[model samples]
Target chain A: MAGLGQTLGRAATWPLTLAARAVDPPLRAWQRRTGTGGMAAVFLAPNLLIFSVFVLVPLVLNFAYSMTGGTGILLGQRPFVGAEQYARLLECQDYTRPITCREDQFWTAVGNTAQFVIFQVSLMVVVSLITALILNRDIRGRSFFRAVFFFPVLLSPVVVGLIWRWILQRQGLLNLIMVKLGLEPEVWLNDRVYAFAATIGVSTWAHMGFYTLILLAGLQAIPRDLYEAAEMDATPPGRVFWRITLPLLGPNLAVVLVLALIRGVQIFDEAYVLTGGGPGTSTLYLTQYIYESGFASLLREPGLAAAASILMGAVLVVLTLIQLWLSRRAEGRKAR
Target chain B: MGRIVLDGITKSFGATQVIHGIDLEIEEGELAVFVGPSGCGKSTLLRLIAGLDRPTSGRIEINGRDVTRASAADRGLAMVFQSYALYPHMTVRQNLSFGLENTRMPKPEIAERIDEAGRMLEIGELMERRPTQLSGGQRQRVAIGRAIVRNPTAFLLDEPLSNLDAELRGTMRAELARLHARLATTMVYVTHDQVEAMTLADKIVVLRGGRIEQVDTPLGLYNRPQNLFVAGFIGAPNMNFFRVRATGGQAELPGGLSLAVPGEGEVTVGIRPQGLHLATGDGPALEVVIRLVEALGAETVVHADAADGTPVVTVLSGQPSLAAGQPIRLAFDADAVHFFGADGMRLEA
Candidate 1:
């Protein structure tokens, strides 16, 4: 009976060992795939889902709503109006009003936004590049200076607007300083020109630091030996900076330009807080126009607001594509 | 061509002095090599000559002009670095023409110079290729070609062949010697390889501990070393030193074994390994126990220990019959042996 039991035990163990070997590889492979896949899904799913609901869904619904005349909440009761809003936009008149009325406000906002983006983004990028170059040098107390420059980027845009508004007020810091010096006190933020200037100044001061830090990183990544070799070859310092440093920094410069352009185009908080699209809408932006059409003031045309937002998104996408194409071409040249 | 002169060149970083009051002169068209172990200031001295670094004190005269305060570009010299230091973004043609371009040379002249340097280096087919696409030897040739186009007063090379593999290093060494001969320009090369110093230099400057130990031709350094350091440094397997006591014009080795000395006083007897032979009969001999034997077909080196446990190596050609733990007698010609005093300076007989 003992011998029979040993034989049965051996018979069972053989099949069990073969089964374990057969299952091991596929099971481990599945475990590895699921482990990485699950971790990736955990990190990416929340942002993807939130963006789809908040950004993508609203974008699609806004395009559909722009083709219709909406008087109620989105996805609720509304009537399809068939391009009437666009026609009204082009005719420079209110469709619902009785007689002919000028609609110069919309066109004025577009021009102001364009001017602001052009002036503000260019000035901000140039200032940031200069600051980054200075900080990249081997100077003492560099980290301290870097922090001091970058402090403004961390502030809320609303707070920045409020702070500048106080500084530019009629009897505010500028006038007070001027009176102390026994000079004539000028009306600072009251006129359209001064208001636009104040808007550009505040935006530049708040955003230049972030771009400076990014460009500094790019500058530091360049090897110092290249400069040494250039010097040995009798290449002058100016030529080294222009030929070697600038061309190598093309990718970083492109990033700063595109980011500044996008932020400049979508500028809303400072203009809304300081100007409220006022002084004849000199500092008004496209976003403020969309907002005033949707909820603020007496215009409650959600379809027009949706159409403007869609148009803004399309412009941003096209601009980003052009920036990407430029970066790729620069990389191709380097490869050659 | 210019005769380079360094007068009282001293360099200090904070408190530590690296190159201490070095003075030397290189006649025009001489291929001089500065060779030493690491941190011996050979590379620093080269940089000083190239005007890449300023001397803490003294003047550098190139062809009888003081260039101590001149910038590297104004000094009119070219250098090849160990890392090759090629501009990765530029093709071979652009790299060769960049220096000329910066000096505002005409476009046609730049093109002509590029073509000439490419053909001279035998890299005409690689002119359009970037540095990353070339092999190590090709890149090195391009680097040399870059230096050649400038027509500088001197060429400074800092271990330019150290980056190549063994086989390519030999080939490049021959090519560099050929290049120097063809160009006939003042060239100062720095290396730590004794063999390279022996083969390529018209004058070898041996350095030790941030100072010049000896400066002479290759055969001069090998045959008549000034000190024990040079004797040990210049030869392969090194000269063996055995401590001896002088009495009555005879030198006594350890363990009471004795040999005749032509002079008096205590001296360290130095003998090159190739000078030693296995005596077939009675001769001036010392008994040694063989520890290890290496056979290389042409020669066999026997590593052995003396009766007093002093280690010694005797190299013999045409394979002697020897084995470990065997007792053997080694003899060397008296004319081939060198004698040094207790202060490590050579003593002439």
Candidate 2:
């Protein structure tokens, strides 16, 4: 029986073997002429082609659109206006009051985004770190808890927004629970402070799982013996965390911080769905401003939206460069 | 002051029991070495004593105080790990002082301890450098230094020298012996290397399958192992065993060879490779054909097959003229011969 099976297997693989033999000669010749670097380029060609078409072309077109004027969707139909759109966005009388600027709504969005970034990014880091530390322990149902925490990250941003809206809306579950608890319920999405705070909370809840996953991997990579050594030293629990656990988790924290910073600046989808830049523009972020200006509003200003997007992209680019540098330094340290 | 006593210690991880019930005592200022093969629970036993792991059912007493339920910090023990386990972010000085600082020791005392450990370990030049910057030997030194500056009641070392190369291991072994002498603290060390156990231990505990096989001085274990397991495990190149039929103080070996040994019925005899020599004028000796010879300048080891096709090995003092397929008679002194009964227990002389 084994002999028959072997014969059948050999028969099935013969054509593939023949094809490989036929290609081997030409591949060897190509390798000999091009060397390893050329082979690397050949392997990278497909990925580079897709990246250029989807990313590079869009970036170039965005920049071109940012420099043009008029309400035309097509670049050729618009007139070159140089930095007029940029100047309009930057023009302000007091620099603090959005009402003094030519693009008051854009200024309000910038102010709101800055506030959200500061509060939401700090909260995300702390929450994610605590969650990662807890999940890294040998607690019962640990994998189940990790999956539950990360379930939100798998959902679409719109879905996440809709889920939270159902809970936080007036006469919703939260209000019903509050009333049952003998507390008066307020309109959560109407109050300016509550609306802004809700947006930050919803966004953090949606994305914190990814950062926690990064941190959990970092925690696991730390050698178990180091913790054992610390225990042997009779070091206190708090000091062990400060002296060993936190320091060892530094590289991971840096990555999480930069990534959370960029994610905070790009906070739009979940927040936009939850608040709709409501309560008199209390939760309008940078991305929502760009969307409203470019495609949503009655007077569509494509040039202004592109300029704002370009500015946001610059911030993201700077953040990505910092992340790259941090990761490189971490790799170098590990190599040493 | 660092006398430790364990009463009925056992450890189980979930359903699997890694360490069976054990009772041991380590005296003050003695270096006790636990030598065994992998998965023998030697390291697990050390961790239990250090309070890094809790026993499943046992009582641990240190200096007459029960510390089985105490946290590792309260146990006042220091440990050196196999991988050195030095905090990679900290400098050598900081590594040595970390424990002292945790104790809220005065800064001047901390500095003094750090300086002393640095000088003692010869790591003063690398004080400002992190562990990653040091060689394996230097990292091991820092790890030991980290343990030393703690000045705890006892020290636990879990295969600390296993990471070093053979040459560095030799040098570090001597250094560790010197360090123990200077400190004069109780230390419980675990290693799979019998040579390390023989050279450095004041008392050696041979363990197998999480059970203690023998506990004795290095020479005691070598000269008289309690059972077949210790007899085989305590020596290099292993002790040679041969089955023989014995009656009335005479054991008849294979190939018409007989020896004066006292055991009834089936008996097993063991001889060290060093015990065997070329039969000068053989009345009754085992005849063997040489299969391989390993010469190491000072001594030579010969591998041969006996007349009954049993493999035999003998170590000679000087290089002897040996070749494959050469027939020779091998003899051992009667006193060097060890006899075991059918149950694998050593027979009392």
Candidate 3:
């Protein structure tokens, strides 16, 4: 029986072998002509071509669009107003009050995004760390709990928004439970404060699983014997966490922090779907405002939207640079 | 005083029991070594005594107080792991003082203890360095320093020297002896190397298959092992066993060699390699064909087979003229012969 299986396996792989043999000579000739560095470029050509078309071209075009004026989407139809859109966006009597700004909605979106990033990133990191620590223990149903926590990460952002919208809507599960408990059932999405808090909570729930998984892996890599030695030394539980667990988890925590910050700054899809920037623009984040200015509103100004997006992109780039710096510092310390 | 007593200790992981019932007492200031092969539960027994692991059914007493159900921290014992287990991010000084800091010890006293440990272990110069920057021997010293700064009830070392290179292991072994003498603290050390057990142990426990085979002093074990497993395990190159039939007080070897022993019926005879010598003239000697010869500077080791194919190893003194395939006569003194009964237990005269 084993002999027959081996013969069948060999027969199944014969075409693969023959195809490799047929392509080998041409590949070898190409390598000989190109050298190793040139061959590497050849192998990377496909990915580089796709990235250029999808990322680089749009970036350059966005920059060009940001310097133009009028409702016209095409560059040739619009007159270049170099830096006027930026000047208009920054023309505010008082930086704190959006009512004094020319682009009041944009200022409001900026305020909302800053608030969201602060609350959501901190909440995400703390919740994910707690979940990871619990899951890392030798408890029963640990794997089941880990998978449950990670289930939201696998769902589409639209699906996550819709699910939370169902739970917190006036006629949804939360209101139903509140009404059953003889309490005044409130319209959660219609209240400014509740809606803003709901957006942060839903976004954190949707993305925290990825961060938790990263922390779980880091927690596992710490050697078990270190904890045993600490126990032998009669270290208090709190000191063990602060001195041993926290210090050792430094690199992973930095990564989670920066990642959560970036993800929080970019929080648009779930909030947009759930709140639709309602409750007097209380949850109208930067990305949603850009979407409304560029394409969704009847009086759409593509140039203003492009300028706002360029500004947002700059913020993201700075954030990404900070993340890179932190990780490099961490790696450098480890190397030393 | 750091005296530990284990009464009816047994440990099992689910359905599989790793340590059988064991009873032992380690006196104050005694260095007891547990020696065995892998999977022999020597380390498990040490961990059980250390309070790092609780036995399935047993009572452990430290200094006349029951600590069987106590937490490892509550038991106040220190352990040095095989991997050193030094905190990577902390300096050697911080590693030494971390436990003391948790106990709310005064800052000055913590510093004093750290300094004293550093001086005692000769690691004062390396205190500012991280564990990764230190060499293996230096990391081992820091590990010991961490344990010593605690001044716990006793010390439990689980194969601590097994990770060191051979030459460093010898140096660390001598250093450990000196440390034990200076501290006068009870210590339970686990290792599979009998040489380490023989040289450093005030009392040695031999284990096999999670059961204690014998417990005695190093010389007592070497001179008089309790069973065949111990008789072979205690010596390097292993003691050779010969199957023979005994009638009255005389036993007959497979190669027609006859010997007087203290057993009747089926008997097994054990002889150490150093116990055999090259025969000079006619005597009660066995003839063997030399298969291999290893000549050290002071002594020569010969691997030979008897006429009926019983393998024998003899360590002969001086560079005697020997080669493979050469027939030789090996003689043994009767006092060096160990007789075992059918059950593998040592037979007493």
Candidate 3 per-residue lDDT over residues A1-336, each given as its tens digit: 999999999999999999999988887888999889878987898999999999999989888989999999788999999999998898999989999999999999999999999999899999999999999999999989999999999999999999999999989999999989999998999999999999999999999999999899889988999999888877877888989999998898998999898888888899988999988899999999999999999998999999999999999999899899988987887676
Summarize candidate 2's per-residue lDDT along A1-336 as a digit string, tens digits. Answer: 999999999999999999999978887888899999877887798999999999999999988999999999999999999998899999999779999999999999999999999999999999999999999999999999999999999999999999888999997889999999999998999999999999989999999999999999999999999898877777788988889999999999999999999999999899988989998899999999999999999999999999999999998999999999999988887788
Q: Residue-wise lDDT of candidate 1 within A202-246, one digit each (tens)? A: 899999999998789878877775676799878877888788888
DockQ comparisons of all candidates to the true complex:
0.35, 0.75, 0.66
Off by over 4 Å in 3: A1-25, A328-336
- Computed on C-alpha atoms, the DockQ of candidate 1 is 0.35
Query: Which scores greater on lDDT, model 1 or model 3?
Result: 3
* Model 3: how far residue B278 lies from native, Å: 2.2
Which residue pairs collide, candidate 2? A234-B73
Model 1, residue B202: C-alpha shift (Å): 1.2
| Cand. 2 Cα-lDDT | 0.91
Model 1 chain A lDDT-worst window of ten: A94-103
Quick one: ranking by DockQ, best first? 2, 3, 1
TM-score of each: 0.80, 0.94, 0.94
Error of 2 at B199 (Å): 0.5
- The residue-by-residue lDDT of candidate 1 on B1-349, one tens digit each, is 7689999888888998898887889999999999988999999999898888899998899999999999888888998888888887789898889888878999999888888888888999999998889999999999999999998899999999999999999999999999999999999999999999999999999988768889999999988888888988888888888888787878876545587665677788888888888867875587789999999899998999888898888889988789999988877777778877778888885
List model 3 lDDT by residue over B123-188, tens digit each.
999989999899889999999999999997789998898888999999999999999999999899
**Per-residue C-alpha lDDT of model 2 across residues B1-349, encoded as one tens digit per residue:** 7999989999999999998888899999999999998999999999899888899999999999999999888988899999999999999888888878878899999999888898999999999999988999999999999989889899999999999999999999999999999999999999999989999999998998989888999999999988888988988778998988888988777778867777788888999898899998847787889999999899999998887887888999898888888999988887788878899999977
TM for candidate 2 is 0.94
Q: lDDT scores for all predictions?
A: 0.85, 0.91, 0.91
Per-residue error for B153 in candidate 1, Å, reads 1.5
Model 1 chain B worst lDDT window (10 residues): B254-263
